[model samples]
Target: KKKKKKKTMEMSLNLASSSTSNSVFLFNPILSGKQLAFPCRHQRIPKRVKPFCVKSSINLSGPRQTLSSNWDVSSFSVESLSQSSSRLPSFEELDITNMLLRQRIVFLGSQVDDMTADLVISQLLLLDAEDSERDITLFINSPGGSITAGMGIYDAMKQCKADVSTVCLGLAASMGAFLLASGSKGKRYCMPNSKVMIHQPLGTAGGKAMEMGIRIREMMYHKIKLNKIFSRITGKPESQIEGDTDRDNFLNPWEAKEYGLIDAVIDDGKPGLIAPIGDGSPPPKTKVWDLWKVEGTKKDNKNLPTEQSMIQNGYAAPE
Candidate 1:
């Protein structure tokens, strides 16, 4: 009976030792003061102990067993770095590139405000400083804004060492007209359908009667100065200029040419003396007016009255 009891005790001790070798112990420093144990093999884990199995495989080859966790830190870092490297350049970078390439094409397609004037002046100065002999072209398509801004650009154009050739693409009105007229003689140009408008300086006066009167006198002086400028540019009598500028006067390309406001109207086939900037092709021959013509209408409307219409309409005919 004693031998049989001793043999049973030895078998029980062997089973306990095998279980302890296969089991993994984990210590939860944060959750519990005691150590929790789990089976190391792939088997049905107890429902209460499922959360403790962070890793499915264990390396038992070394004295220190290593758990194969799901976190692959090296691969994650590589993916993050690749994503950052593939991003496109921002708008500021594109703007810088455009500014560098668009040095020769000076676009005045907005209101001639202080900002516009400053930009135009700086571009003109840069162009002149780069190559004084190279002719710089100024494209004016403004409805016209601050007279002060216009004067600033006008003075810069006049003072620049480069010969500025102005082209009117669409509407050149008020101060815009002044800019067009300021271009180098024989180089001033206008698109066939573009319009040019001129008028006296306009403003609103406020404050005391004395202040208002002073402002009026100042305006009159500017008006006279503008009249002289117009007379000089158009080769017209100051009286005629004053009468024409009493209200807004709009002129077609042909009328502008006759009035000495523009040297010539652009012909697509013949760009005349105007030279292209850099490697840019010459302006296309298709005039805006031609695009708007009726499909079957006469190509040349000879019935249209000539400059004689100016005299008949009570305006001085161009000489």
Candidate 2:
């Protein structure tokens, strides 16, 4: 190879051209595993710095995770790509946004699987522990999934010290609707166009006759539990809830409010009914939630020791 002079190559380069053209020239000759250095007029700039390249692994774990990696290059223009990459959030901005969201907001926009349940419950518990007096907002827009997972979230919301304000954005269906109704009373709201749907727990059982029988029994138990929840929240009869949920029962915002599923239809700027505080009245308290405690089931305390029996033993309390 002939050795080229630095002065000859410097004159051929155009300073007025776009930075992308300069980048192309910088990498073209280096593909053959050889160092190609070019001289520039600016002495203040550092010389012979190689471009940094990053290698990333493709994740194929889930639909959501996989979809983020597969981008259509033909859909985006080069200018849009350049602008998007240049305008990424700084570390400080990202940290601030994350902190704000964790402190006050719990958004549920996807199907409520075990992972979603865990994340929402953990955030609610942590926020309640941090500042019990402050209210936490939960925005839900889910088509519903996993009755067991949704029940976990419902229990967590009841156990938390902070009052959760549930808001419906697009649609809250099935388990999602149940969670919305489980929020602190007088704090539930749905948008003007949002839809709320309720129905019986759905599942597909596959196996022998015994296994199918067990699955049917379990599903019936969940349906009964959910019906009781709706009855309690909406102040309706359990029979009425059962009849309505026999099929898909979708309600508009006005219909939801009329059915007592939500307190108000959010039309103005007010985010549902405000909780009354500092009016010489006792603050509202939360009940201890027991997921397995179905109604009409009596606890057998016959085996438990009474106070009289405790006195005969050494476990008596002294005055």
Candidate 3:
């Protein structure tokens, strides 16, 4: 019965190809049965078998076109086909925000969950790898989420050799504010009306008494670490950061600058950090904070600070 079935399958394949030179053969006959057997007597038929597809191009009315003898069946695999389709997808049609990524800009507009943080971290790393001397602009408007995830992104930013310039759009709270402060010094900026809020890490403890206690301790450690990070970024005393972050400290752009959370408040007439390519002016110089070397890492060269007279305060130095 097996011999008859194999003969029938071979005849069918032969007839299929012989019917028309243009007809494409689209399947392998050997693996058509319930199980695939090998010629070796010791080899047994596997319980499962992978399907294969074979194709032959047909010439319709036009001139004959033949595939190269070097054509590889592996190239027509389902996985390869899917990957090719994915590569051809339109970014705009897919609604992927690749335009900013192309410009070395990463937007943290959503909560800093694992997915969001991973994407931002990857973009930062990729952009840095592309051009270590170029600045990576990070636009942030997030309420924040996941301290661990945010820390991962923060570490990635610091790990990059390129500088990161953070911009605050609408609001930056919790871990968002931490990231805003993590940008290269003298390069951080906030929209004129934007706000920044810094506070101790918030969390809920559950499960068991021991688990609750452990979680609380971990939160405390994170708070201390955050305070140190802010102190280092803002050039403020750790005590000040601790007190300020004890509760929700909301600061407007100017107040944020005063609090050392940002370097400047962007307004009209401000050149800001968005410089067109091929512009005669050189790219702004920035300082990258190295996680390994925390002290004396400030850059002496910085672009001229854009001045805006403070209405509330009589006179304030360039922030």
lDDT of each: 0.75, 0.76, 0.77
Clashing pairs in 3: none
lDDT per residue as tens, model 1, 1-319: 9998778778755655777755544545676533233335435556774555466466666454212123232443556657888754445424632343244547798999999899989888877776778777888899998878998998899898778988998999999999999898888988766899999999879999779879989889889988898899889999989867866888887778888898877743336445433332233445654563433133333555568776889776245
Residue lDDT tens for model 3, 1-319: 9999898778776776564444443444767554333222233456887889977666487754321222343565578778788544344423436556656788999999999998999889888887788899999999989999999999999999999999999999999999998999888988876889998999999998779879999999999999998888788899878867866777877778778888876663345775423322212334552332234322211232324534335455334
Best TM-score goes to which candidate? 3
What residue runs in model 1 are displaced by over 4 Å at the alpha carbon? 1-103, 268-319
- Every model's TM-score: 0.56, 0.56, 0.58
Enumerate clash totals for all models, in the order shown.
1, 0, 0
Error of 1 at 115 (Å): 1.3
What range of 10 consecutive residues in model 3 has the weakest lDDT sum? Answer: 292-301
Please report the TM-score between candidate 2 and the true structure.
0.56
Error of 3 at 211 (Å): 1.4
* Candidate that scores best on lDDT: 3
lDDT of 3 at 15: 70
| TM-score quality measure for candidate 1 | 0.56
